[model samples]
Target: MALEINMNNFKEEVLEAKETVLADFWAPWCGPCRMQGPVLEKFAEANPDVKVVKINVDDNQELAMQFKIMSIPSMIVFKNGEAVNCAVGLQSKAALEELVK
Candidate 1:
């Protein structure tokens, strides 16, 4: 399962995580976001070392604003508490692995 992150706890949960963190910024009503869901799940399963998180734009408005998430399916990967990679679209598991790697 994906850990939920929001502006209220983003700093503590994502920026302060000890390991790599992958944040999927999405919305429930978005078609593309729904399509990307399974891919994210697979990525999370394959990368247990990385903390995979989900930030719903509807539930976490502040986080979406903070991240400037204009897209429905955006992903930000953080390592050592800093964003190292970002993807803004539906992505394959292989593509995410390459970025995270």
Candidate 2:
């Protein structure tokens, strides 16, 4: 399972991390976000080198706004403390891998 992140730990878990980070911005009420969860878990299991985390928009409104997350199931790939790529929608395990690569 992907680690659940909030504003409190966002910097330590993602920004300061040495490895690539994949941050999934989502809300529990969103159907597509719910669907994306399992896929993200599978991706995390398959890709041990990458760090996978989930940010609940409802719980972390500040983070959601900071990232400009207008859509649920939005994915942002961070490397060296900077956002490198972004995707919005339900994503397959293969597609998730592609985002990190």
Candidate 3:
């Protein structure tokens, strides 16, 4: 399962992670967000070396606003404390793997 991230713990878990971090910004009411959940879970399970996180927009509104998340199911890939890439829609596991590489 992907780690649940929030505004209170964002700095500790994501911003400070040493490994590559992939964050999926989602909301419970979003259909696309629901579809992306299992993908992220599977991806996280397969890629143990990388950090996969899930941030619920409804719960973590502050963090969502900080990242300018205007849509659900947005993914932000971070490395060395900086956001290197972002995908703002439903994406295949292969595409996500490519981003990790």
Candidate 4:
């Protein structure tokens, strides 16, 4: 399961993590976000080494603004505390795997 994150732990959980982190920026009301949730879970299950997290844009507006999240279901892959890849809109399990790779 993907951990739900907030500003309080954003740095510790994502930016400072040793493993590759997949941060899913989404809101509960977004249809696409809902669709993406299970895919993320599946991805997390398949790739145990990768860190998966969910950031609610409604709750973490500052984080969203910092990441320049203009759309729902935005997926950002972080490596070595830097954003290495980003994808907007809903993504498949295969696509998520590709992004992390």
Order of candidate numbers by lDDT, starting with the best: 4, 2, 3, 1
TM-score of each model, in listed order: 0.92, 0.98, 0.94, 0.99
Poorest 10 consecutive residues by lDDT, candidate 4 = 35-44
Query: For model 2, what is the error of residue 6's alpha carbon versus the real structure, in angstroms, after optimal superposition?
Result: 0.7
Per-residue CA lDDT of model 3 for 1-101, tens digit only, reads 88899877898888899999999999889999899888887888889999999999999888889899998789999898888999899878888998888
Count clashes in each candidate, considering only residues at least 3 apart in sequence or on different chains.
Answer: 0, 0, 0, 0
**C-alpha lDDT of all candidate models, in order:** 0.89, 0.95, 0.89, 0.97
The reply for model 4, stretches above 4 Å from the true place, is none
20, model 4: CA deviation in Å? 0.1
Q: Tens digit of lDDT per residue, candidate 2, span 46-87?
A: 999999999999999999999999988999999999999999
Q: Which candidate number maximizes lDDT?
A: 4
**Could you give me the TM-score of model 1 versus the true structure?**
0.92
Q: Residue 72 in model 4: shift from native, Å?
A: 0.7
- Candidate 1 local lDDT, 1-101, one digit each (tens): 89887777888889999988889999999999999888888898999998889999999888888888999799898988888999999999998888787
Model 1 regions lying over 4 Å from their true place: none
2 or 4: which has the higher TM-score?
Answer: 4
C-alpha displacement of 22 in model 2, angstroms?
Answer: 0.5
Q: Clashing residue pairs in candidate 2, if any?
A: none
RMSD of each: 1.1, 0.6, 0.9, 0.4
Write the candidate numbers in order of decreasing TM-score: 4, 2, 3, 1
Q: Over all chains combined, what TM-score does candidate 3 have?
A: 0.94
Q: Model 4 misses residue 71 by how many Å?
A: 0.2
